[model samples]
Target: MRESKALQVLKGRHLRLEEPLLLSTVSGVASTKPALIRYFDQKISPIGIITTKSFQVTPNPGNREPVICETTKGNFGNSVGLRNPGMDQALAELRALRQEWKFRCLLNVSLSANSVEDFIMLVEVFSEVADILELNFSCPHAAEGYGASIGCSSEISSDYVRKIKEATKKSEVPLFVKLTPNVEDIGQVAKAVVDAGADGLVAINTVGPIVHEDPVSHTPILQNTIGGKGGCSGRWVHGKAVSCIKEIRMAVGDDVPLIGMGGVSTGEEAAEMVLCGADAVGIGSAFGTVSQKDWEPYLNSVLAEAEARLKPGKEYLGPKSETYLAEDRQMAYRKHTVTKIAYYGKDTIILTLDGSLPCKAGEFAFLWLPGIGEKPFSVAHNDPLTFVVKKRGPFTEALWLLSLGSDLYVRGIYGAQLENERTDKALLVAGGTGVAVLPALAQQLKEQGTEMTILVGTSESVAGKALLEDRLSGFGSFTCVADDGKNGRVLDLLNGLSLGPDQACYLVGPEIFMAIAAKKLILQGMEEEKIYLSMERMTLCGIGMCGECVCGDRLTCQWGSFMRYDYLKEHAPSMVGL
Candidate 1:
């Protein structure tokens, strides 16, 4: 399976290295930094190295406190307060990596300065030694006059990128501006950089100096009592990253190529980034998957697998499922029937299609709204595709505008199956639109006349209650809660609906609600796998092409739109956007 054109572009550009490969640095081992070099060398490829920070002649100590920690929220936060070994030492490290590596590395030299002269001087020093000079306009953790201090204010970031572009006038060395995701609208900042003559954009430099605590102590883990949360990484950060890439791609069009990074762990992850409009994939956490010895082999295997998965000629990333559909008439339209359609309000509608008899109980169908776009919606009914949608945005709006006889586009009978139906009576919990899939499962149980109970949580919206009433008419038993007292509170409903230990549970709603519910249930001694839930992330590529819809290592569009509560709890912190 050859790579789709979107992926080929990313893998095509070859960065030239200096010398033979060497594993001289283990300090950066946790990041698989060396394997990046080895990946380029063995693969005979050319990619850039985003070098660590370096200041001007004057040295500055970054945040001098606890930089990293694990939080109860299941995420890592660090206040690596701009700790650098000074310019001379930093230059030496870059020189060493340059001298021994096979492919020529594009040095994204990061530097912070208070004045124009300071930036000029640093660029002067790295001009000869470095490939691309990245002006550090977006480090959220820096002191006054540096990092986001300069980048956040468009005027400052623009002036700095312009100055550096002029200083490197003699050389065409591309100057990239590492933008901060902390901004209200990152696209506006990206536009500023482009106008300032930045060669390209390196979006989102982490969410913040997030903090993890000692579970027992229940106190802050890091010494830096205050942390500027940087870019959210791991699985949670995927959608945010994609959103940034999409905004930049939309704003810039094709004038400059994008180097997308953040939360990418596999080749498929890399492929997804490309489809959302990235030229190359910057992998950092992927190194965590393999050991030092297995780095080369791991990179090789993932690269091969990713290449095989992509389509032949699509500008976007992933396997290009839509593109494939365009080519083969036989593959274009799949057959499905609308089992049920419930209109909650003028804008909100729930449609349960039929055709999922071939799939497992919890599997989902990829709902494509033609020109509108695509998203992975869990099967509300399952015979076909039962979706509860509100006229929220473009896609959902388009769905609302759709009539019953209108043609609907859909793909993928994809997702994990409920391998063993829990003979243990089941408990189903839903929130808002989360109840879309509950009806189908309920219908199945009702037909079989099995023991099942459903609990739905919603806000004080009549539409929500209306939809719930329509869907739960035939279930074993049903309860509805409206936060505003119109119905009842979700918590109230749950408290009222009791079940014994021999019951499996499924939860689908807002993340916080599910988290709270799962945590409470676990304390009640329920098995982790007994509870399941739905998570909605940015699902750019339905076939798991774009890693946009990720929850830890799994693609919500592929492995799940439905996942075990235990799995989610384990990866929740890292799975931020859920």
Candidate 2:
């Protein structure tokens, strides 16, 4: 295959890439060992560079849960607090990745101390394995006197850059300084860093320490109680990033390479960044919005747009910001009104939406309640688009309180869907709210003329069984297992069950339960590949970007929410929870 034109010589180093689209400083997606392995192994997109999540000298636990919340007009507010596994763990992971990495990678490093010694220490350790070193002087959510605190002042930024440059002089890996836009004049900081021996610059980390609160609870939504505000990313920060790049380019006069990033989700946006004087564009939140499989298509679209504008005959004016915004708005989030709500039990409710979005049996959608926040839910039914929610946390509890006709925003249909395989017999096992996905899966299997036996394990009393039998009646043979003897535990029922060679199993429930069930089936001579398990994790974006849903190398939102038993056994053994 011919090499991509996205390749560019930066500071005498040939940065090879199929596209100028770089996975930006998304800590969740690009930081971890598993995430990086997934990126290089999948080769989903020939992205030129991948920057690891920002790390400090010591491990930072970061803020509490609900660290990320969707803002109005296609932005995401996150206060993850720069949580990273310290320098020692980070270097260890990078050293391993260096042996196998096929693409150029940058290590985004941060200093937690005011002393220049800590900065030098970080540089020396990471420079050995990093293809490029990116000094993160702009993380907004870092502890006091760190991150943007260092970048906001030109003198401080210059001093830090100079010290780092001196530290890495031996290795001489191209050093890029990431600037924070929260400064009074980003141009000054850019000029100072460039003059202080920086080879390149990544403009505009997230903007603002935006906050969100739960309306009913009268408390902050983030687990940090009253969350320290975090930077805003995604579409909202695009304009700020472009303006910063333009100013920085004007200040430095184009000699230094500039990597423009912030809310760059489309090809048009990438082109816009270039027009604003960026040599390359970085993508962060956009990746979170798409699945692992969609990475190539999404990135290619941006590359094609950038390439089209760079054509010899094409005279590139500037990107039409209005047009791009309009186009992005269409894809961001849409309003859906609740048409029906039925209580399955005291805690579980099935909501029917009036929206007509295309969705599959096992796929999920993100439900957004403006001030409340967004959460991913598997589509319970598709006719009118339904979501079955269990009252688990603040978000779900708020969702449960909503009455009919309540306005809500919905996005996605993301993740892989259950496959309709030709089997003589299929077993569907579910526990708790996991049964929500079974009705749809069962319906699909019934349509395919496959015999299915569904076993539901719930702790709820028989009265809590409300309408389940009615909903699943036509789908297949049904069995309910309550913890009480009225029924029985699913495992007890399974103990007596028999399986033929042609029998297949699909399981969705608690991690331990599924792991045990899979083990049991395997011992019963069921082929590992024939058994499928639906997984759940702290899925933030419902796409691969957030890294929250990552279970080993596989991103549950992209590679699965439903995974093959054998694949999990080999690739994500720890996730098996056996």
Candidate 3:
């Protein structure tokens, strides 16, 4: 439509963005949870704009596990339920964010609501710190009355946008309406919102409230009200996004700001956004491409690539600062055959797959059963890839009953590696199914030449605890006790436990068990830093995109499955409370 120009000015009330070729996070993936936002602020460049997850007026628990997953086509579909820490906490977080970054990076606060009045109310409150108030009118899988309800209809969208914009005119905050492509006439919806007075347009939120199934089991993945259907994004929808942005540009006129995003992983793809008349690129699922440890350097390269490929008023923005080497790589799944299955009675079983997985102790992996679903399990044994599955629900039940030689889809080996620090000794405590996490750790300590002692607790029904006793005993020390065992349970073993000057204690099980165990160790004069505990959460995406595995500001999928006690006490204090 016109010559490319520098995208330096994002223009909310004022734009302090440092880069010309614009970059912003698409809400719901990267920036959410106040602590996560702070982590990104420290790592992400000042040029990068931070967008929050779509926060509602009240707190949202979001969807159940199997909330987000990958499609066979390498795309992602999520029904994350617009989870957020209600407005009250959000206000304090946004205030703290200001203190943390001090406006070094611009904040685009995203809001979602069912009504125009509620939207307007959110703008008023969030505008206090928001450089740009992003109105999320288009989350495909959110509960009814939320995102898609406002975005799918031009009449509904126009009326709402006009009202919200009218209310915010005095606040002078730029209202960028996020649009969905699920509508029949997306351009019409775009024109209506723009004519009503949106300061900017974020084209194409996700396409299709479609269903993703297990390839064999056909079990639906997303846990939303709509029968497991979700919106698809990533490389699969980039074409749709480009087309939507182009149509929006045509409908709104060349002067309006547009952020085109979907499957933007390369300089060429970023160039496609600009060519389609986008002022900025919205990066969504591509954030899943890099693990959290590599979040900073990886994103910097993507930013450099986009900046290098663009032009501002006929001046070629050349010399990309960095190369996106990992663009071609994705967190992938490998197929394995369930060669061995061991039953610990009806409730618990061990499933071992053929071949080994490359993983460190304390790291975990996700196991997928096509047509069934995917769930994360601690790597019980990396070599021969074993998992001790306890029948918790349908997911584990399927695993427990799986026939030998059946296939297993495995991905990850994700999370922080437990540092192999040689100490005077190592003490391991396991409870119920949590015993699956210890063998690999025991192996690590044994290899380090550190003395090892293991304590395990499980159901009384599993009478013959031979497997549990045998595996851990290989590491030098083993003690197993059940709920009704004569040994007075595993907790009894902790009483007057001998203390080593430089021993490390790794405990995994239920929260109460860990808390009480930690308290006992502390009472026994153990160092808090020397005590490590595995924090379990519903993990999806293996990476941090799903927001289900956050332990404080830390993404447990990356920062840890096992974090030291001192760190948890400060950041994840909820774990410390009995």
Candidate 4:
């Protein structure tokens, strides 16, 4: 077991690091796979599993694009109307995991219904197959009158919990009710769930359905048009998640297990969740943002750093700014490229500028748009440090107006480090603008004589093919997919490629595309350790302090933007962005 300063904070039921456990109730698919199991054992020990919602009885496709999005904050927004494979499939997956995994698995079954009976039926069906069942009365967007709509109401929350309590009378596994952060006072809701017999609580799911524009299309990014938009998360969401956890912890007292999530991407962040009242932490966006190959290392690094910081002699690296830059040679800039613009398609213009340092494939740099503010963008390449940007916000809009050679202020190689050292077989999955960083990664992989395959998914034909011809040309074996049948969906291309077990799959782009890919990989029986994916989120403060990026137990900006696909497949399935 790893040592942690947080060990002290973990007392009573809160202290459980038998292995590195994560309250991974956020993943949608790939819930129970060997790869996920391996990741938990290798990266985070003493693991727990949380499967995505399988409706009480039927299978359903959740939300559509703009199911998740990349805002200036990091990545947020998902309108996935509670899609799941239903309880039958969920139970089968659970039973399989219980029989196979060496560790004790906690299946956080997220369920929703229009009525308490719907919730009860769900409980009865899968209650015996898993360790824990989470009542997801708090989903921001659900089929009419379901999910958060009911969770927000104390009466509804109470009745639903009570019904499930009665239904699970023979089940020893505890029941955790996962709540939303949208309420003005979530304490009341927490009390209701507890009084109704919830054994534990997973405090604060994503806070909103905030929407953004497509700049060029002037249309909503999501296909659902008007559902709960995926909320922004990262350092920004920390205070809120903590506040909610603290309040709920206080309300329920210490007897009830309280798991903290949201904006937690590092061990320190997870420790904070513990301190704030979470017995365990849940990670979502962090795992979703990066490729699977990068996932375990990212979690291990976060936990390792957190453990180090908690030690007696360790020095805390507060924010990675003026302090670290001075002591670390890696942060210093080798050369400065003042405002330089490169045309990316017809609608997007990538601006490269000067700042703290150059960027690597998995690392991100910050762009300060003066009046519009600063934003973090993945370093597309280091040979020529670049940012693939869309003309969305005021700063970016103003940036578009600038001619080539215009001076642009840049800063940071902030966020988590990339596993540039890995020699694993690589599978790159990119969606829309996500293809930006692949060029550099592909280039390096090719240079190293590593075989690489790039799969790009998009909804448009022109955009899909353009990414392939213009940017991905230099990379080995590039394939593009368009949902509208523009060229071919990346999924089909992947089928043709015949991925092997040794290959590490990496994904970026829209959340759903990544989710589908991750799930597909898992179903294909790929090791989760070999699957990789990336997620975009609302990142602020660059460092881990801000809580805006927490998805279950991870923060995308600080802890990851790169991760193993299996890590995501096991936890936070819905938020995977597939």
User: Which numbered prediction scores highest in TM-score against the true structure?
Assistant: 3
Instruction: Give each model's whole-structure lDDT.
Output: 0.56, 0.70, 0.77, 0.60
Relative to the true structure, candidate 1 reaches a TM of 0.46
2 or 3, which is superior by lDDT? 3
Task: Encode model 1's per-residue lDDT on 319-347: one tens digit a residue.
Answer: 33122111211112354545566776455
TM-score of each model, in listed order: 0.46, 0.77, 0.84, 0.55
User: Which stretches in model 1 have alpha-carbon errors above 4 Å?
Assistant: 1-50, 53-56, 72-74, 96-102, 225-231, 312-578
lDDT of 3 by residue, 1-578 (tens): 12111223543211212345667777887676676676666667623667888888999988766677776545888778788887888888788768755765567889999999889889999978887788899998888889998898899989998888877777766788999998887889988988998878887788888897755444676777788898888779989888887888788777777777877766668767877777777776866766666666666666656555554443335433234233332345678899988876568888889999866666888887755667888888778888888788777878876897888888777787787458969899988888888877887787888888888887775654576668888887787787764422788789999988989899998878898899999999999999989887767677777666877677888776888889889877887783
Q: Point out the higher-scoring one by TM-score: 1 or 3.
A: 3
Q: Kindly list the per-residue Cα lDDT of model 4 for residues 281-376, writing each as its tens digit.
A: 777655544334355555555655554544546554544211121132111112344456656556666655544344555667665532334556
Query: How displaced is residue 510 in candidate 2, in Å?
Result: 1.9
Clash-forming residue pairs, model 3? 214-371, 217-370, 217-371, 218-371, 219-371
For model 3, what is the alpha-carbon lDDT of residue 320? 38
Error of 1 at 254 (Å): 1.3
Order the numbered candidates by lDDT, best leading.
3, 2, 4, 1
